[model samples]
Target: MSAASLPGVRLWTGRVLEDLRAGRSCLCLLPRTPAGGADAAAVLDELLHELGDFVLLPAPGPADAAAPRGAGLPGPPAAAAPPPGGPWTDTAPVLDYDDGLSAFGVGPRGGGPVPSDAASAAGRDTPAAHGPAGGGEPGPSAAGRAPERGRPTAHDLADRVLKELGAAAPGADSGPAAGVDGLLHRLTDGSGAASRVVVVRGWHEPVPAAAAELLRRLAAAVKAAGLPPERRPRLLVLAGPSGLAAELPEQVARDDVAVHWWWGVHGRLDTATVVAMARPPAAGRAARHQLLEAVAQATVVEVCGPFLDLAERLAAEWDGSPDTLPPQLRRLLCDEGLLPGVPDPDDAARTVPAPRGPAPGAALPAPAGALREHWDRGLADRWDGRLRHWPGAAARRDPRTQETGAPVWDWEWEHGVRTRIWLAQNTALLPLLDEAREAFTEVIRSRSRLPLPDLAARYGPRRDGVPGPRPGTAAAPGSAAALAGMELGDMWRAHIQGDARLSQPEADRLRTLWRSRNSLSHREALDSPRLEGLADHLTR
Candidate 1:
């Protein structure tokens, strides 16, 4: 499937385009994983292709070992020759713009001013004549300047930007170079009628301190420029692994830079969308639905590429067989305890039956498929054979055995199942839980007559408005301060339920949410009924 067609891609790209059109430059953070990186690139490329005028640039590398750190300028050349095809090499220019127009509809060639007639007709001064609204002297155009002999510097970057935009390069005759500030002037000064975009790819790689500093300056300049959306140039930095943002200087990493996650917000794929992508070719609708349910239940992170690979493997191995269970599905069922293991034929023959007429009751539910039939028969025969040899086996074999006494639950099995369910669904569940908590907190703040400050003093961690010890630190077990730090669950139980001003129905609604919140916190997943109830209450 086309990456642009994906729901996540569509949603993310729309926001990115909106940012660009509004004249706000973007910092699109890609996932660090290989598959994630490729997908993110595809998504970004598709958006750039649609928007139509972007220059793709390779990220710069460190100049030399002795290069000054975070200086925001290029260091002197080292004695040894720089590696061939490296960012420093003249053979490979920093900016790639040749295919920008033909293939991706980006990086339009000329940056000359709008025609005189067009400007006069529009009743506005020619952009080149008046210069950019934000005043700054234009630096000597860096046009045709040989790339600095050593490692590429911020100066090289500026020159490349100028060249790609068709602005003049900083030659010896053009006067002192304006560097990045000059590049910004060229971009915003309205020297070009067409919208310009500069994209730095592979930014997830380790960025030199100087380059990082240069990026900070560029972003700061763009933000402070205050040009209209149409006039400002778009700057996009595509980097990875979500955590890469921390490595950026504080200025560039701030809220001013628009960060968009290619993977869903938490690096997890949407369950329903992933299941749909896994649909097997040539399967009946009912069978497909059942298979999707199994896949959805089994998946944890549901990474797009890996899950699709597994699905392809399933299709190849199954080969349209309807009677036998697919090996992949069988493995999933065995792991999830939905299917019983094959029994020993010798044991089945040796043990005698209890001779009691079939115990009158409805049979247990099983998944649909021929494999399920085989499993049911094997299970029944195994139990029947053991019944006569083992005392109380018949009682234990009853599906409704729990009704007669306290159920003998396997704590390990229960824990394993709960853990799997939580892993599969937590991405969706956690956000909903957060929203519900916020809503409930607002209810208490607005409706309850209790004094907010007093409530915090009584139940919050900091009694005197002073910060407490870091979370999970050792504190006196019985101290009032130590026992403080009430979570949503605790707040609902200790205070909301007891509030006289709150009505019973409202309290009950909050109680349901509290239960759901507690279950999730404990790494347990709620069943559909409870999940639905939580959503309904929150929506109301």
Candidate 2:
């Protein structure tokens, strides 16, 4: 296919430019036997036209070419290429247009290379136009004198690009859509850091606990990196099979801790997804729309992955200066229609301290149901009252300023949200309490099944219609007393004899579990008849 016949040339070129400047190599694998105008040919043609210095050449047949095409050049139109004897010398950008090209090799480009282990990997969605030169490993050949990021293999470029694209940073790599095993690393290790893992895992798994563990790892990593996690919410790239979509947030919440996370994930990468993601809008929190708008922006071409990466790098990127201002200014705070420190936004701010608005005489639009409620919170100081907070973190209006305020120095970042979600995803409660209770019940069959709490966050009482933290869950002020009051031993004995129809020996084991659970929750051990029953049950 000739350059005139290709489509998507613009996007292809943009990706190429992005890779080239990022110091990544690339290739376009073309098919020699015209498979009758495939999409790849059109893309190749577009790339050829966009690329001035590149030239077309016949791929080297098993036998030598009469004149040898793709290579053997001062490297295409000298007018546009890098000039003589400078930092950019040996490095002139060249696009080899290969006719009879079964594949086009971008040459370790920051592009997708064909799979080296295609057999084991199964489906190859987009096959590379060309395998690397010499076809040794993958990407570009290593005949060059200097060794680069790797040993200058044909794959270094693609590997690097995938490394960035396919990274699984803690919170970043995790999601409901991604499976634990679905994340496959195509590149070698010791590449650049993932910044954060962005797995696309979701809650479709029956065992929610597995998903929680993944989130737990992410929080751990953020703390270790010393990033202002409270301020900067990192991106989590998530792509999962359809219908299983809603499972992402639900699974994370099983552990309860995931409810407070500051992580964000991508659910759309195409226009269709963009439209589908945005709908008539749900009647939930107004801030949810803000979250939706951000994801929707990422779905269309309006945003690019590398640009997002760059933005995040800038947001979280520090010169290691102690004077580093909060990334929140970049991530959230906007001044006069611009985020702080942004050149264009800063320039606009210099001219006007506030954002442009409706004409002076025009009335502002009235807010809606949920929106009105949220606005009212910041406005007249009323609570719709769905939110629960760490005692001190709850907001209060300043008496003088009349603005919504939090008495605490720091309000909870979304980290707590993610934590709550994490607990839900794990189908878990606190280790010492729920875990021991469940283990004891299963271990002691003779006892009545006292029906432990239903892996839900709120099990015990309702504080003002909302479920408060129950006995085994992460309790607040009165947690310890609540568990003791349940009278688990007597309750279990009755349950076993009456409900489970168990004898005294079986009831004894469950009695032990009740005591052990209480002891563990208080960070102690038990040695009495009840605890000994549990010990005996475990041994048996």
lDDT on C-alpha atoms for all candidate structures: 0.44, 0.29
Which digits, one per residue and each the tens of the lDDT, describe model 2 over residues 92-169?
A: 122222132213221222332333433213212222212233655432221111212222221222222233454443
For model 2 the local lDDT of residue 190 reads: 24
Q: Give me the displacement of residue 193 in model 1, in angstroms.
A: 6.4
Best model number under lDDT: 1
Per-prediction TM-score, please?
Answer: 0.41, 0.17
lDDT of 1: 0.44
Candidate 1 ranges beyond 4 A from true positions: 34-38, 58-149, 176-178, 203-211, 223-225, 241-250, 254-256, 262-269, 281-540
TM-score, cand. 2: 0.17
Best-performing candidate as measured by TM-score:
1
Each model's Cα RMSD: 24.4, 27.9
Whole-model lDDT, candidate 2?
0.29
Please list all clashing residue pairs in model 1, or write none if there are none.
Answer: 32-241, 54-107, 141-168, 141-169, 141-170, 142-168, 142-169, 142-170, 143-168, 143-169
